[model samples]
Target: MASAFELTRNMTIGQYIPTDSAVHRFDPRFKLVAFGVLVLAIAFCNTYVGNLFALAFCLALFPLIRIPVGYGVSGIKPAVPFIIIIALLQFFFSGSIAPGGTLHFEYGVIRITGDSIRLVIVSAMRFVEVIFLSSVLTFSTSTTDLTRGMECLLSPLEKVKFPVHAFALVLTIAIRFVPTFAMEMEKLMKAQASRGAEFGSGEWWRIIRRTKDMFPLIIPLFNLALTRAEDLILAMESRGYVPGEERSVYTRYRSKGADWGLLGISLALAAVILWLP
Candidate 1:
């Protein structure tokens, strides 16, 4: 019964799988930089061939990083319905972008064309690429690594009075708390189910009923999250931790040749993919 509400099973974004492959060994700073470059390239890519190449590059990283392809992609399963709806909307009302392209179908205001098809396909591919890259990043890097990496990457912003340290800490905490919240929700679901609360036990097509059933779990989850956050705040305050303060690092990262090579390869790949016809 609890298995039905197990979010962590398919939630791979915030979860780390310590495979200790070369990808994991790369300096987090380099990894973050590479990730940013690839992300920007993918975002601007609107062509079918470009997106296909980008997606292929992203998919190939799973094997290189030693993460199971199935597990890495399983996280997107829950988002399929939402993605489908958005794709349909884009496909139907895409006349603006497809004005000069080949027209495929027209029904009053709704129009489908070559450009529309390209848009939908490219958008979906970009989404999958981003998800895959993100999953790979989190799967290889730990919360500590992510925080330190982000802080280092954004450190220059501190010269202009930006709260880089605090921002990095907050971001890392938000990510780290995802799996925590999932586990908490699982526990809450099980508790509620023990007390005769129905959850995830209805016809698949009954969306309204399913949503209503989930309402009972939402409030408790929020309360639990708030409580945990408050406790974290108290603990941090007790430890004399000051936000935006110059913190001493116990682990200073030194990038290796391979790390530089990895970043170079990523940049080259992004450039090539974006240049694809």
Candidate 2:
């Protein structure tokens, strides 16, 4: 039961799902750059072929990584409805930037909003791609590896008054807790379900009743978050943390030749996506 639910809810976000596929052996740094590039490229596609190509590329990745394409697609089920609504809005939007944002379209008693349609579709598509790509990376690479890679990428920020080490620590904490929080919420849902709490079959006023029903679930989750935060802070301090101080990392960062090669490939794909459209 736990494993199946794990398949459903968390899906190894920020945790590695071990497989014998080529993707598993690739450097996390390479995956990170590839993931980010794929996002920008997918967003830039204005033509159907471009979108199809991007989709195909992403799907092709599943087999290479031995993570079923269906699983990756299914992960986005919760977000599809929002994507559809945004796409529809985008299809009706009106206006161009060059024309001082004049009313671009008018129908009897109705005018389409400027920059609405394309923006929404683009936004929704971009959102979906980014989410899936992140999932792919998480499913392929260990959370620790991803964190180390992020620290290296973000290291440049140290020159501009950013505490890169602290940033990495915070990111690491957030990633670590995603599954914990997911599990807690799942328990809340199931507990309500066991009590025969029907989330559906309610009237307009029933909305309030349903919301009130969530209180038992909400309070516990809030408490859990606070408790976890306190525990995390204590753990950090116990390890001799000093505020605003940099320290040597327990982990070392290294990028090999293979990592660089993959990084180049990721960049090339991104360039093709943007430069084409």
Candidate 3:
């Protein structure tokens, strides 16, 4: 039962893996922009070959960043079921097929067509590409760097009276709390298991029972999150923190030649992929 907690160890989307590699050393602002471009390219990809190219580009980043391929892919494990479900739904009901297209299966009004199958495949590829690219960014960058990057990237919005710092702070806090909450959930699960609560006992009604049982977990998790948030607020207040106040950054980010080269490559890749026929 304790081994179940180990599963959360691979949930690496919000966790940072520290390494000394060019990807890790790149300015976070440039990385953010490049990642945004990659995501757009993936989303707008129209052909199977284009999606495959996008996926290969994402996969190549793992070695370039010195992160293990397994670690880069681990984040997608937990999302497999959801991805499959979405793919199935799209396949069955997307209506992408033209009239008189080949039908693979049919039951009443539900039908699967070759075009729908292609759509699902492309959609799944897009999902994997986006998730993997995001994992690459998070794994390579620390929370502090991410916050600073976001702040700098959005600084231009301050000219319009936007609360840039506050917004960035909130985003950073939200991301920073992901692993904390995962740990908290693991602890809660272990505690409940000690009290003889059986979760997923392989019984037929196990799914239903587990669903109902989750309410107990949900309430406590919410309370714990709120408590943590309150503590953080108090700590910040005691330290003379004020929202939307000017603060001096301890570290400055400078874009190097390598960073510019990486950004240029990313832009060129995006343009080429988007231009694919």
Candidate 4:
């Protein structure tokens, strides 16, 4: 249980790291736009060379933001099994191999071809690139900045009667609760374990039993979440935070020349990746 708690605590998603680096100092709005463009570019990349460039770009951001490469890379470890499953499905079942292509292997109904292999490789690279790039964004930006930046970016939608501020608040609260809930789960698991509830005990039958046993943890966690939500509502109401009312931020973000330069460079790199032959 302690090991489980430590593992959950080490997860970096939805958590921010403070650093005095240019990437961390950049305006969140700019970072949001740049990240969107980079993700789109990565998604569209099909060739090995383009994917290599995308991978290189993602790796380079770690040092720029003063984050350890291993730490950034560890963020993808949790998804590796899923990624491998998807890649294998794509490789064996995609049916994308060119006519008359060299076949690598074949079974009763499954086939492996050069084109399928290439597609799987590129898809895997894209998955890693997207996940690591997103991790960089969350690692460098704080929850407040993310909320404000999203609100500012979505403010233009207010002309169409959209509740931009409310949407931003909800998004922010939801993201902020991710780590909180993870910790809560860890605590609940520890408490249960103290009562002789074994988890991941390595016996197949015990593992199956533990799976059923965990269902009891869900109701308590949900109730705890609801309690927290109520507390937040009361706190906000006590502070006179009315929805749709004009409110000023304590720290206003202003874009500088450096911000623009960074955006420009990101855009240029995205263009180059898209235009690569």
- The candidate that achieves the highest lDDT relative to the unseen native structure: 1
Instruction: Output the TM-score of candidate 4.
Output: 0.84
TM-scores of the candidates in the order shown: 0.90, 0.76, 0.89, 0.84
lDDT of 3 by residue, 105-172 (tens): 88876788988888889999999998888788888989889889999999999899998888888888
Deviating ranges (above 4 Å) for candidate 2: 1-12, 88-122, 200-216, 239-243, 275-277
The better candidate by TM-score, 2 or 3, is: 3
Q: Per TM-score, what order, best first?
A: 1, 3, 4, 2
Tens-digit lDDT track for model 2 on 13-113? 55458986677887776777777777777866765456655666776777778887777777665455456656765556433343555466677644555
Sequence-dependent TM-score of model 1: 0.90
Compared with the true structure, the alpha-carbon lDDT of candidate 3 equals 0.82
Task: State the TM-score for model 3.
Answer: 0.89
lDDT of 1 at 36: 94
Q: Could you tell me which residue pairs clash in candidate 1? A: none
**Window of ten residues with lowest summed lDDT in model 2:** 1-10
Across 164-211, the per-residue lDDT of candidate 4 in tens digits comes to 999998998887787677778788888888888765565433434655
lDDT of 4 at 250: 93
> Could you give candidate 1's per-residue lDDT for residues 231-260 as a string of tens digits?
999999999998756779999999889998
Better of 1 and 4 by lDDT: 1
Return the clash pairs for model 4, or none: none
